[model samples]
Target: MANPDHEGDVGPQVAQREQRLSGLPQQVLYGVAYYAEYQPYDRLERDLDLMAAAELTVIRVGESVWSTWEPEDGRFELEWLHPVLDGAHARGIKVILGTPTYAMPPWLVRKYPEVTAERKTGVRIPYGHRQDGDYSNAAFRHYADRITRKVAGRYAPHPAVIGFQVDNEPGMELFHNRAAFQGFVDRLRHTYDDDPQRLNREWGLVYWSHRIARWDELWPPDGNTVPSYDLAWRRYQSQLTTDFIAAQAEIVRELARPDQFVTTCMALKRPAFDPRELNRSLDIAAVNPYYPMQDALTMPEPPPDAPQLEWETHSGVWAIHYQADLARAALRQPFLVTETNALSIGASHGNFPAFDGQWRQAAWALVARGARMIEYWHWHSIHYGHEQFWLGVLNHDGEPGRAYAEVQRIAAEFKQAGAAVVGLEPTADVALLYSRESKWAMEFHPPLATAAGAADRSSYERIFSRFYEGLFTAGVQTEILFAQDFDGTEHPVLIVPGLYVADDALLDRLAAYAHDGGHLVLSFRGGYADHEARPRTTKQPGRLFEAVGATYDEYTNLTAPVRCSGDFTGAATAWADALQPTTAETLAYYEHPHLGRWPAITTHEHGKGRVTYVGTLPDRELAVGLARWLRPNPDVFADRPKTVTVTSGRAPEGGLVRFVANWSWEQARLALPVAMTDVLNGTDLAFGEELHLGAWDVRVLLERPRKKDDEEGRPLA
Candidate 1:
């Protein structure tokens, strides 16, 4: 029966809306995954109201709706979906309809055994869990394409439809096998388009392994760690996945008569797969920051001073400064905080962990950092997974639990502050390229000693963790850019901390950036090798070191608390390397007891460029010193707002609001330069107004009115 509410799915434009995929409105988008199975129309409808009450502009319906969208092969079901889309639209929320393909129904997988790829041990598992489905399977790919095309073609012109989110988090379960490896090997043979010698040059094969002969001889390497041939092939496979999703999304756009934006949501912390790759493929790349949630119950202890996420699986950003820093840097477009927890995790004591005022501050902290879209991972707390995966922003009863109230209040206050700090980009003086390859390749494995120490679990991880903490305490705006990501003209101060393996081509770009009067910093293993992690194109310390006038004499892993007698912020009792500079100046000497007279820090000049190198990871105090030494007090402010100042991007809308957030439960008087109207309370501010910000209160200076526009007797331009 045609749904009475949807009005027979209306216009050609209405049909096009289903195919459309644009970002939500100007205000900060607060969203929750509108799970089809768990939430019926009424609940989905209510949550949609709460979502808007919280100022959410986008509603993401899960692809698990496949059973409803295309119940059986070749049959389409729009009766249930039409109302959901129509309901969200009626409430002024954009709908991001997911393509029904993440988890294939058991019926399809069972019927086509060819769908499940074999493991290295030759055991083929059926499509069972959420992460199942073989991307390489023709049948799987075909059906996914067909269903997605139908959704796109049918709904592309709908006004309420803003974007088409194709598939939910693909490539979850990976195949590290010879067959998948060989598939790519065959692909590589076809690379250079039939010139065999070029492959030898790149692969460095003296005698091409007999295991690799014709394209058919290839097999996807069946191992957790990629064998050489498979490493390059994995990139190809990643490309294939990108192309597959892109093709599906494109078809929907084409057939539906494109109107809005389109993309997919991604798990940012995936080890092998790159978020950059995901970002590259999508229009508005959404991220799941489940950093503290998955393992929150396992977190060691409450920090004496601060509150951290529960179980931080990927420790670096989850716990450290890189957490928000990456969000500001990764994508140029407005980003989304697609996941968080209102209730934290369930404790071993048989109760759900609750959020305090601190959790509320942290959520705002994400907003201050430029999260255009924020959603608690799940709406209702559940009794599953040992209470480990804390996805709920509300309790099971859907009542105003502790976190629920906090999220509601903050979102409500922000709603009154229209487009205040929504679209702001990350502006930073310090550039720390957070390389995917560095995080994945240099993190840890057998043979290679991590950050330092023989028996240490993961030295590099430890160093990265400590470095991020140090940088945060130092209070500098830092960005994570990859060596591959550095555009020719980068920021003024570029700091490359650990196992850097940029190819010569990339090194030349870095040199040019340095040559263009920018400052560069290197420490420990800088310019160590090429992409393959081999001896590198130009040898130890690579070619750029010479340009920076530095040479790496040795790389030694020492435990921290590095002690030096000189005037250092704090001693570096341990370090990872002892570098020597040629025709350069030594900033800090490695005179520590164990360091034994090697250079731990140095500075040099090449062309118009300046380079600084740190041989060891120092304490936070010294890191502050180094940060000061890089760009110094110029970025420092005289008139301070609240400790938490928010800069946003939604400029077309009036006023950029900076929330001087004072969360210590203490009153704060903050000095301001520009006068602003409080979007939340509608209070007006005068220049140099001292804010009597109450404890746990956010005194937001709504829109900083422009002097030029004010002088012209018009609304600030």
Candidate 2:
């Protein structure tokens, strides 16, 4: 939806109209986020007849009011959302709309206070919250391109709108203003071409003296203490938030309508987010997963010193399927949850809604990970200002309670699993990878520490969520690659945890994906630094040290847990790596006596693949015994109960589905590992029978026949 030549590429005729979801409607779209300008009275025909008696199809609407769509500047009230999009297209819902430009209007911050935002260099950022200005200010992109072309030219031919969200969660504030630090010193004078000594020997900048001979003696990133100048000022503030959401998806694809569509909701812990270069200028991928509901979605988790939730939700249930496998790994297809947990999300002493069948077990675990749409994040409840108790789904007396009868039984089980689970596709044995420039060079040099010792800047999500919760507690099924979309013959078990800022062409493509047979793993501070966060002096895991047969210039940081013995036992917290194997084959060691002379895990082989490595940070029963020895084939509801989990995918005729759930409150059971069919109950079971489930249940099923030459229900890229 955005090829206006900002040159960040998305062309191919706008990627073939964003692979057609054009006016959506295949199913799985249950909804909310209907503001009706935060209704205090006059219920827009009782919120579109309780969103068509709760079998809602969609809603979204006016992204958090830019002062009720410009109450004063250029004075345009634009028919107050034309009776909420003509009463949500008279019942059969739909809508979406949204471009109120991340709430700025206090009279455009009292008439352009130099478009606010600074957070340090001059310290501005005063105006009341909501993305406090400076979206690369040129008078804030001329009033955010005149209210995003007057709200996409006043709701582009609204036959129940269809799509457009533009900006409501865009890289929240990395704008150290003064035109975002002179546009990061004119993008470092066109990325060092104006060579300030080749950006002083590629950012080593001769250390403390901070070299730089010109290019306006480059400085500002708030007193930067250089980690390759904070990973090139966090890759130029995530390329000014992917050039302000690809210039608002090229101003809503010049008034939308090639069947609408255009997105931007990703609040996936935004530190100047990237979302694979902002979903290459939007046309799909939307996020905001938000987790932690009741017993924090149980399942023997809640330990590593519980009491979490310090914002941007997510706590367990393998972090809600790792935020729906990171919103289906961004542009790797099927997405859109937009906002989640419609009730009790943040502040009001952080309430914790969802219990009776946990909103159908987190909407079938975000539709078994690929998620076509869930919506939430509202629909009544705002009785006044800063999210008054953030609870919605018709609360604060708007009526229909129990989170609107558990989102109307998950919108009648997504309308009886319509279109066999809309856009399924999710299936992965293990791939993981994910970097975001090694999470912005481990948030500028944090090699794990916190336990009060400081500097744990979530050390790359604590070493990639302990190997993605040990491949979701060894029921394995991951898929989140990134180093420019890695392949290794379509991931025959990749892993690669804290790949600390790699380069040498991604360590020669993970040593040629382990000399071509795959199964590469490697963990702890991988290939220790290269792509400008420097450090690779060519020894310690650098440049895949002989395909990781192992080497380590000593490492430490474990304030407690240490154990570890033979074939991968538990214990090995924080950080470690002292391994000195040579042609590798140690598979676990350190019971600690001078860290048992090295090895805490190792392996080799290399040509026709097999690398392994690890060297510490396992714990979680050594990441579920190294994800059940790197996925030793099982998962077809792998003997259930541990508060059951399952997952699976494919479905839209090519059939397979699965989902399962259970998340404990007791009654669990399992058995049937094949002959299926319940898809929200059209019953019929067989193959080994049983199944059951109950409390916080979920189910779904499908399976029998429909394989259509299944390459495991294709779609992984």
Candidate 3:
């Protein structure tokens, strides 16, 4: 197959980056998942033509049709994929070939019934859908390896195949059969040095007559009521996913060439395991950031007194930005947007498609945060399947529409300034510590609920979002750091929201961070439990109580909204802690009828740094106040409107590249901090001059080159 001519405009930087192995794209990688097996050869040919016209540079295929690749048992008919691969290469598109292990062939499942995952009750999950196989089963691994190696060996040397997706969103299910449970027990025994006493003690298994006498007596987290045990089970399940993906990655590395990369996309919202841990084994990080814009609207209402969000809740690309930032941190490098809604449709609700320029805006949001590639969920809407209605770039008629046109516009933008965008590296001084362990603990037993007995399911997420949006509104770029990854030396200010589960070591680390001159912020119910979600055998906030200089003995689930008195005044809701400060200064207190004089917020100085403890969820203004207090002197776009967000990074050409985005419905006007050139429009902007931004619009500005003296670290003239 002869390579087709370049269809769209190609930038100089994009042309220069063609020889690179692994890094940010020279130009953006416009890709889609193409299912040639589902279409006739003639239709497939026409689709490739249209793909080239749309300036698509990459295509992911072969991952969806394992049954087509190998119909009979051990009968690998791999020749059918050759045409697709050749066609992609001929169209000047690289291929991210997938290991067909996510879904099992019917023959393999029929021969090995244990390959399917079993529920807690031992009922095997029926094998009609994808991701149904047991990740830890030895039999499953054997077949997974065989089929993966068969595909890898055949395509490892293919010129068009640039990388391999080890598995499709590897950790979406948990296998709870006999083998998996035995593996968990073995891991626990190994962790506790084969001492059942230590295991029972650490896990607090003596509660409710749940003590384990022997290692074998320990059960999988099926119906266990113990939060510690359930947390351990979830972590173990994550380990299984990591090991499963690693196994496939190792296989690919052994067969593929050095230039060929390996990665697995994450369907992140409810990941079966920690994605950060799993990405360590892969070459690059990728996430399917399904920004829940419409999904958020359909969500159940919160408690009557709970702080409700406005239309700005999920209107923008912060969901994408947040996930991309996390993915970049996980890989410690630029990552990829493996999948996003081409038309914003889902399985149940048919969401409205991208309106006008929203698609380009969302795409640029990913690029601004260090996404090397962005691919739509699929090329076209499937004719038959559960996701048939989840529309793609093309409608069911397979014709280019509004989304396709938007993508073309994005391709042209990349051709113009892809080099500048690709060269920039995102920087953030504010970091939010995130813990999956804490999330799991909250799931087991949330700290707050509604007066009518409705579970405040959004407690953890709400608190985190409150702080995140606070930082965003304060014009601070933020990075999400996991406990294992953060040592507190990277960011000057760190905020941890609702850290319900933590180890003494982590608590000590937080204290050390404050002692070492880092500003620390802790929210309500933080440090209340050990790493396993067991109540720490100490005071609330546990070992870090000294660092925080405050201890909470009593808390309340707020039935009505309350306001704060003292230093900061704002509405508080959901929960409040009766904090007694020993060496800390009270920043705020509850002004309620009965709760008056109770400390709502406190701050303590430790060594060269300080720690601030918030006892309840503060309203937006108060959250921003806390942020402003933590980051005094106003370096970033301070005092900016809550609807505006600023993300700044070092541009490829030397100076800073700032992305100013307005996610609100009303027009926002902000003064430029410094004179700069708008890269998006090639217009020069003056310092301190107010610039207007229409709703949902963004401006990418490159800071003007500094003076020669400034370059030498001299004072500006």
RMSD of candidates 1 onward, in order:
7.7, 20.1, 6.9
Ranking by lDDT: 2, 3, 1
Which candidate leads in lDDT?
Answer: 2
Per-residue lDDT over 1-717 for candidate 2, one digit per residue giving the tens place of the 0 to 100 score: 011122123568565555536668778898888887778788899778988888788888887787777788888787888988888788888888888787788887787788888878888988877888878888888888888899888888888888888888888778787777887877787877877898888887787788978878777877788888888788888888888888988888888777788888887788887787888767678888787777767885764553356674348888877877777776767788878887677788777787788877888888888788888888788888888888878778888988888898889888877888887878788678788888888877889888888897778877888789878877788878567655344557788888888778867877887787777888877878888888888898888878888898888988989999899788898778888988988988888889888888898988888889897888888889879888846666667778888878886568768888888789999897557778777898877799888987888887776355654432221
Question: Candidate 3 has which clashing residue pairs, if any?
Answer: none
List where candidate 3 sits over 4 angstroms from the true fold: 1-20, 294-316, 450-452, 456-458, 632-642, 664-668, 689-692, 708-717
Write one digit per residue (lDDT tens) for candidate 1, span 132-247: 56666667778778878777767766666766678777656555434455556567667657555566556565543533334453333543243334446446656656666767
C-alpha lDDT of all candidate models, in order: 0.58, 0.80, 0.76
TM-score each candidate. 0.82, 0.40, 0.90
Quick one: RMSD of model 1?
7.7
Assess candidate 1 and give its lDDT: 0.58
Task: Order the candidates by TM-score, highest first.
Answer: 3, 1, 2
CA lDDT of 65 in candidate 3? 75
The candidate that achieves the highest TM-score relative to the unseen native structure:
3
